[model samples]
Target: MKHLLRKTTAWIAGAVMAGGLMLPALAEADTIKIALAETPSDELAAFFVALERAKANGLDYEWTAFSDEELAIQAVLSGQMDIGFGTPYAAMQRSRAPIRIIFQLSKLKFFPVTTTKYEELEDLDGEPILLHSRGGGTDSIANVIEERLGIEFGERSYVPGSSNRVAALLGGQADATIIDLSNTNKLMRSPEADRFNVLEMFEVEASDEALFANLDWIQNNEEDVQIFVDALLSTYRDMHEDPTIIRRETNPDGPIGQLPEQILGELDGFYGDAVDAGLYSKDGGGRVAANADLEWYSAAGQLEGDPSDLNIEDFWYLAPLDNAMN
Candidate 1:
């Protein structure tokens, strides 16, 4: 099967080299459009650092910060963007538009937080839950929880961020929600920590955020994609070598560098924690991560199929990351 997957990649590469794929409206020479799911902050410093590196290598790009992950996916689907930050597994399966995840930005390092009323995941049986968005990472977490714990949840509400969900929990507006690692740490350290419980969850190394685009578009703009992937791979490796490098390489005149002093102060710590948690795989999540995603999103109810039966090449065009490594 692994050998067949390689052959599939070879076929795709051959086709791309032959210019067999149709060119997208965003032509090969046009600036790449990147859809950011949220406003820039500490969470995106490393990505911005990579962008700076890509820029140094002559990759032209512009980024739009969408309201949420779903909108980001929609932007790419609508051809309003060239690439986006998200896991569009559901859209990929349902649309069949040859959308392929190129690189994984972060892993599913989220924690399920609840009030003292729930002691475990199973205890939340049929209980209302607050989440990040309709089809985003938190929603998939909820789906996986229901499947794994054999407990169906009641109402599922959408708030945008983990910090906002934390607010809802504090204001008595919500009792449970899933949040990222940094926010989870903050919540546990809060004075209201006694009021909540961070449920013990099974380890999930699936992608939480990734870069994806229509395969035709990627093939059309192979050079830019290669530069971008190379820059990202270097940044992830450098972060593992020393997380402080993100803070150091942050472009002082760019988006991440223009943040408030407090956020800037925490950038080093944020990347440090993220690297320590293995939030990014050094290979940038090609074949292994694609297979893991199939297993994960399948169990999470986002994709329909026995995981092993899924054609990984359909959901992931690993040629870019593969070439970047070589």
Candidate 2:
């Protein structure tokens, strides 16, 4: 099950190693291989939905899952993976990975969970904190804390996964950590609820995850790329138009329905919980890129110009998504 969520090895060797998302005439003919992160999160589900739809539209494809976003970007840069699920906007701004965010994947809407000893972000200024990794989503949240509340965390540690980070907090090893919807929901319902406090802090703006590809590869496989992007646009429309479509599409026997038993058991309840928490959406149209432009500009210290004066198209090439949707 963990193997399924982190499918990077097989696909990287077979697809990305060969060349981009396209197959040469001498290469084995199966499907275009795409890179994905291993977990069965909403982003993965959306990609799976697009895969199914793309298949129906005659666009056959395979998938490879990486352990984390950092590796996913490396895969695309090295030409070991075609299009991975998501990459942080900061990565593009900071790294030499010749990649572009082709489509917006998802945003990190976090809930701050702290040990009961503290009540707010201000309360966490002088404390030890935990996160997924040095440059992961949770770490990005910590940066927001320094930027907004004018507080610096006393000590910092990386735990590599949000679930593990959450465990660190639960065992009284750390004061606080920013976690995703799934873990956040689980923690709130746990009997140890009395041990922590979830704070409603200022939202962090980021293009949390995005579909990225080797720009050179995408330049050559225009036709296949259009088909792939089209399917995603369709799924995007459905996902935001009605979040419940997720539950309906995720059959116990289907790709999403076939999640690890533990994660599967929580699907329906999680989906409902996510919708109520403003986690999932059905109106995800052009908002992701727009948000990404503003968010990245600010995070990169480039938001000085009026957001209205900024030309977002300079940062995004929506032709793939546009061609796909049309």
Candidate 3:
């Protein structure tokens, strides 16, 4: 009886020790760190909606916003963040970062706004144009324009913010500039509205933002990734089916609610414009958008070699998104 009791006590102690060692691993597996390329704005309203869903599903995530996409990319590359927002095509291709895009956040819906001096795209040839940043969406648009129209404009990236770019155009610091949907609407409604003209922008079937993560991290946390993607996919479909869902799901104590009153006031209009413009992809998996991204980026000189030669599988891992969609 003593010998049996001693064996039982030893087994219980070993089991407890093993369980203690597993606790931290379980906790770490549940947490995800995300990085955003830009500050919280109306453009990210749907993401905020999905975040609420993720929380409800027991997925823990924390995010930080960086001033630029480069910084966000670096954060992910350094393992400081598990996921990153932004399309960093060139940097990813050049550095061969082990990042794979899992979700397409938004389509390219930027507009080219200019002072009254430039009435058309051609009119701005050889003139200095304000863009968001080098290798950003606006810069890609400029690249496509230069290729299609056979014209070149002096590119200036002094201001990375869309609102600041609009201000530059209004203040005569720039003759022409490209700004996002919100800034475009604000400029159109401003007192100086008559002074600016929105040129007809060429449409590109490219994504403005994508959710990417390190390939190893994704493989290790496949289940968590799927859960996050599933929540996001459902949120996209819900938003498309009912645009007002954005206002409904917005948490009063959440990030969107915490935004300045003036910015929050524009939320309805911002999402309304997005739905009207077909900004969000109806297909949550982003397969079609992924193909389009290759072509658009390659054409814009953001990617090297022929787009046809590039395999979508190389840059995009659709398993998580695919599982989410189904």
Query: What does candidate 2's lDDT look like per residue over 1-326, in tens digits?
Result: 32222223242223322434453222222356677655556436656766667767776566666676677666666565667755445555555545566776666677779888888889888788877655656667787677778888878887755677788888878888888877887898999888889987775445556676656667766776777777777776776566566656664555677667777556557666655665533333244656555665465343445556655554456678665555
Worst 10 residues of 2 by lDDT: 2-11
Q: Supply candidate 3's per-residue lDDT for 194.
A: 95
- What candidate 1 gets wrong by more than 4 Å, as runs, is 1-26
Quote the positional error of residue 31 for candidate 1 in Å: 0.5
Model 3 whole-model lDDT (C-alpha atoms):
0.79
Task: Sort the candidates on lDDT, descending order.
Answer: 1, 3, 2
Order the candidates by TM-score, highest first — what do you get? 1, 3, 2
* Better-scoring candidate (lDDT), 1 or 3: 1
Tens digits of per-residue lDDT for model 3, 51-84: 8897787667777888887788888876667789
lDDT of 1 by residue, 1-326 (tens): 00000111121221122245443354454577889998887888889899889888877778888889999999898677779999999899998467999999999999999999999999889899999888888899899989887899999989988889999999999998999998888788889999999999989889999999999889988998999999999999989999899889988878878889887888887888888888789889888889889999999889988998999988999998989899
The Cα local distance difference test for each model comes to 0.86, 0.64, 0.79
Residue 323 lDDT in model 1? 90
Worst lDDT 10-window in candidate 1:
1-10
